[model samples]
Target: MEPPSITSHLAPSGEVRDIEKAAHTAAPISDPSVHVPTDTVNDDGLPPLDTSPRGWLAVVGGFACLFVSFGWMTCIGVFQAYYGSHQLSNYSASTVGWIPSTESFLLFLGVPIFGGLFARLGPTVILIIGTILHVGGLLGVASCHTYGQIFATQSVVSAIGTGAIFVAGTTAVGTWFHARRGLALGIVSAGSALGALIGTAVIPVLFDRIGFPWTMRAVALTYFVLLIVAIATTTRRPLPADHPHNPFRISHLAPVSLLGHSPVLILAIACFFYFLGVFIPYNYIVVEAEDAGDGVRSSNNLLVILSATSTVGRVMPGWLGDRYGRFNVTIGFTAFSVVLVLGVWIAAPWRTGRIAFAALYGFGSGTFVSMVPTLIAQVCPDMSKLGLYLGAVYIVIAPSVLIAQPIGGVLVSAGDENSRDRYVWLKVFSALAMTVGVMGFVAARASYQSRVGKGKVV
Candidate 1:
């Protein structure tokens, strides 16, 4: 048999599907047994978008989850610095780097499984379990004494919980809004930037006053409260009223055939390369600044600046992406990130220059991070299958996130561990890696345009 055509899901009329009725009518009842039959296709094979207040509320819930989950992840630089100077001070930078690397690896690694679970068990169960694991893992991290213990607590335990929240929160937003997806995702993603900005500033203060253990406990408690709010507000598919399976079966989810689809293939390749180098700066820039003689306080402030600028970077691209194309905005920003890495970052030798590089690079990188998923959602053959596709995509990139920072650590630790010049090669490596990332995006965009025609908004 011939492979399936993605266009089959699009409306023949080429007009946006009116999902307002379904949004209002489907699953209005409080019964969990109700399953609303969704319009799986519209003019673009996107669900009928309901730009409802409730939908935006789901966005807020997602925002909260990301704030606690990814926000903490983004603040890895703080921990990297802390661990190197204090707890794991005896370990080499490259060895100490593995902790956060493992954390990132697990964060993306479980997406496929989580995606499968989201489709089967729904978001509520996933959110609740994720909240438990996340809170518990953080508490565990607070009390852990050794490198191995910290790895088990923060990396394995905490990472899985973060992944669950990530998959559930992001996919929940997808089920609600289609037209405003880029904007919604952007806003939700900005929560990470907000969280990072706040955490980077507060963490050091907390570390000094109450110390590491209580600081982590305090963060865990805050996460617990926020996750509760997130779980309460987030709902998947708004209770589909007529579905056959009361408890969904994994077999009923989107088939593996989607992996072979052109868009999926190209997009996955793009994401793999993009992620490989994308995280390096976020993970290592503060360390680089610290090594350059800024010391601890200034390095933490640099993280704050980077994340503060990233907040704007995260949201603005979403708005721009909605009007322009997501691919256009993403590609533009990804390319600009190359310049920031090669130019501003590599050339910056002083405090002022480094600060400028932090802000600009953070902003440029934020666009790529915020808009890449929206682009993926656009090319997805079925709106209903987005979680599955994202899961697959993240699975492909998980290794990249796992190794990117460790590789940076190796480069910085090359020859002498204390040499500032050691970081120059890492910068060069990131620039080269990001260059390949841009090429992947360009290739994917070209392939998408060839099939859909250049004029389509996607």
Candidate 2:
């Protein structure tokens, strides 16, 4: 079946709601059993969108959930540097690097399953369980003194919670808004910027003031409170109305088969290469700077600088994406990221140069976590099936994060661990990976335009 034209959902006279609403009249609400629906699709068979109070509330819920999950995930560099000098210092960078890589790997690795679970169980059930596992994992990590203990608690169990809330919160927002989706999702995703900024800035200070174990305890408490708010606020759909089944049957969710679609296939392949090296700066900035004779404090400052710029990166680009086409804005920023990695990160070795690179790279890569879903929505066959399609895309790319971080660690060795490695090869590798990522997106754009045609909804 040919998918409904993007035009089908627009209001009369071809004006999108961002400007003028087409003639749309919502149903009467006199019957408590039959709730009124706004943002209804004209004839696409997709679920109606929600841009009302309930929609924004879902966005808030998404914001809190992501702050703990993807937000904290971005701070892995801070932890990596600290671990190298302190906890797992005895192990080589490659071996100790497995902890964060594994945690990142598991978090994304479980996205497909978690997406399925989100469809079946809804946000509250999934988030409640995620909170328990996540908080419990943090508490466990506090007492861990050995590599195995930390790996088990931080990488495995905690990662599940992190992935769960991320999927639940993200899908909730995805289903909520259409006209303002880029801006709304950007705001929801900015929660990660908040988390990354706070975590990067504060983790080092807290470590000194309270020590590692106590620091973990404090972070865990923060997670508990924020996650509780997410649980209370997020809903699967704007309700009094529920998805035909609040407890949906798993089989009804989009299946892995959707990956075979040409656009999705191309996009997933692109993400694989992009993700493989996209995190190189994030995973290695502190260590790379420190080895080059940048002091620990200076290196930490670089991390903060990167996170701070990411705040602007996430929101501003998204606002532009809403006004311009999402594809144009995303592709433009993505290509700019390739330039930053090669031109700035590779060629510049001075203190001033590295700081500049941090700010630029952070902004350039900021849209990725927010806009990938918006892109996915463009090609999705059905909105209700989005969770599975999103899972498929991310899972295809999960191995990249798993492999790249360890390889980056190995690349830190220039003949010996003690060598003042400049990481030339790693820089080239990251650029190349991101380059392939760009190529993939360009191809996906072509495929989507060919299939869906021009002037389609972004």
What digit string (tens of lDDT, one per residue) describes model 2 on residues 1-458? 97654333321233223111221221110111223455554353434655466768989999999899988889989989998899899999998889889888888876777787776678898898889888999999999999999999999999988988888888887766655667877888889888998999998999999999999999999999999999988986533222233345554333456676777789888888988887889889888899878888889888888888887888787777766767777788888988998898878866887899999888888887778877776566444556777787877888888888889877777435453336877888999998999899889877766665555534
Predictions in order: lDDT? 0.77, 0.77
Per-residue lDDT of 1-458 in model 1, one digit per residue for the tens?
A: 96323353322223123222232332111111223333443333333445556678888898997898889999998999999999899998888889988898888876777876786777789998888888999999999889999999999999999998988888888777655677889998998889889999999999999999999999999999999999888876543343223344564243344556676677888888888888788878788788777878888888899899999999999888777777878899999999987788878756787889888988998888787667767766444556777776787778888888888888887735455466788888888888898998888777776666545664
Number of the top candidate by TM-score? 1
Deviating ranges (above 4 Å) for candidate 2: 1-50, 238-254, 415-421
Candidate 1: minimum summed lDDT over ten consecutive residues — where? 26-35
Clash totals for all candidate models: 5, 0
